[model samples]
Target: MPKSIKQINEKIKKGRAVIVRADEVPELSEKYGTKKTAEKIDIITCATFGAMCSSGAILNFGHTEPPIKIQKLWLNDVEAYAGLAAVDAYLGATEESLDRGIEYGGAHVIEDLISGKKINIKAQAHGTDCYPRKLLESSFTLKDLNQATLYNPRNAYQRYNAATNSSPNTLYTYMGTLLPQLGNINYSGTGELSPLNNDPSYRTLGLGSRIFLGGAQGYI
Candidate 1:
């Protein structure tokens, strides 16, 4: 039976769906044939992702007593963009911290926050008539924030670019240090568990596609 995603979703809701892992597709296809395998499976979980698919967090610090509009924000010594709202800021994973250097960044801050560790908070704002506050220095944990949302705009690509160094001397890059003369070829994404690879034709994927993002249920 040719089952559309809508049909599969209906089956899933009614407890009639059969799900399998992406890696299991080959064996099942060999055992039952491609057509039968396709008919039997309602969902194939493509369990994959990589650190290269770096993401960020949107944090709502909530309002302070007679809050001032924040112009600059820092979390755990990492500068977070606070141009959005009064207390809302975004902590990017790749953002480097002044104190920790490149070794520690927004990702570490997020990890620390999730681990229930205290993070230093600092902000500067111009005082207003109703909100008369200028400098705000504080500390917070993950629970302290009104909302912390994991917002990932980047994902591992199916056909990612390969980086290589052809120069006589070593070259340094964001991917890592590359030796000269093609000493290393860094493939950004290997396609394993990539949604595009799992659904090559994008058959079942569309607007509002459900996914597990950072271990949380989310949608595209």
Candidate 2:
């Protein structure tokens, strides 16, 4: 049976951290000034967002402003299990589970999407340290699912489950660790809007649950 909004809301009220997966494009041509190609690009963009079908787990809404934290993870392979697989790999990277609570919560949330609601998000708590800095003030309104908020299936997994399309739940996780250690990406640049330099909008966006069950790549 499909889980009602009430059931999902109840979980959130009980302090269950959610994992919301925003749709990501394989490239950020406009942001990087690259042309559309047969392959993926280095960074993702705001335009290539899958907001409509992407799932969301509302933490709490009674606050003056909805606060949400989003953490992004990138994998080398876009086809791998980002949530489950990545979580297992990053376990040893940290000594404390709360510090690693994001991964655990993320994996469980993704599994919830696959297995449907009726699962427990309470036991998967990470001590509530990582909360989104803001709520999703999406461009989409009740009028209709705007094109800006439409969900696009960029891969096979999405294509198969078109009927049950929904936003992902929100959670926490780690990212960018390998970027510094691997040297695959460069953190030395100051652009008009760059996360590395702490762009206001970008930093304020904070982290989300582990949505990238795949891997991240770079262009030489």
Candidate 3:
């Protein structure tokens, strides 16, 4: 007989339930009946290694005694969007430096900050009565920020199609360089490692599922 929810909970609490990848379901199902197999499996994990995940971090520098409404901001030479408030901005992983181009981006800045490296912070603003400072330049590490957290708008992709160029000119895109005249085809994720390929129906992996993200545990 299939186990009830209570029984499953008890088994999980007592460390008796088995955990396996989604791909192993067929083999386990053959050995045990489908109903019994479902009861035995406690968790299923699906992974996508090479997905083009756009990630970023929102950092808030505590308000200064005399605040200034920032019009422009730069973190470690990479420009960050600062239209939210006086001391709040978001730095994207793919954001490139205006002076240095793609050599340095928000991802590198984040990595440097995490490693306890001091990063240059430059801000410019028009002076006001309540916020009098016009120009400010400082250096800060991760410890100096009030809040810093990764906030990625789009991370995992269920599926994607291949891309190729038919035009006579080279095209540069987020998917990388495309040679002229369909010389090469570009694909994103590996078939075996795709999350959608492993869990086609979203059985165990869905909303509120626990996941490993950025060297820590997170939820989707």
Best by TM-score: 1
Q: Identify the runs in model 2 with alpha carbons over 4 angstroms from their true place.
A: 1-56, 59-102, 114-117, 121-175, 178-182, 186-220
- Count of clashing residue pairs in every prediction: 0, 28, 0
- Measured against the true structure, the TM-scores of the candidates, in listed sequence, are 0.81, 0.18, 0.72
> Using alpha carbons, what is the TM-score of model 2?
0.18
Q: What count of clashes does model 2 give?
A: 28
Candidate 3 wrong stretches, greater than 4 Å: 1-11, 17-42, 49-54, 156-158, 164-170, 180-183
lDDT of 1 by residue, 1-220 (tens): 6778788889989999998887788899999999999988988888555555458999999889878788898888899999898888989998999888989999989889888899999999988886688888999887888999887666634446578999999988866788999999876653545667767787777768888766678887
Superposed Cα deviation of residue 91, candidate 2 (Å): 21
Q: Give the TM-score of candidate 1.
A: 0.81
Evaluated at residue 128, the lDDT of candidate 2 is: 32
Ranking of predictions according to lDDT: 1, 3, 2
**Distance (Å) between predicted and true CA of 43, model 1?**
1.2
In candidate 1, the residue pairs with backbone N, CA or C atoms under 3 Å apart (3 or more residues apart, or in different chains) clash, namely none
Instruction: Estimate the TM-score for candidate 3.
Output: 0.72
* Each model's lDDT: 0.82, 0.27, 0.78
**Residue-by-residue lDDT tens digits, candidate 2, 135-219:** 2232112122111111113211221211221224322212222322233432222232223233234433333412332122211
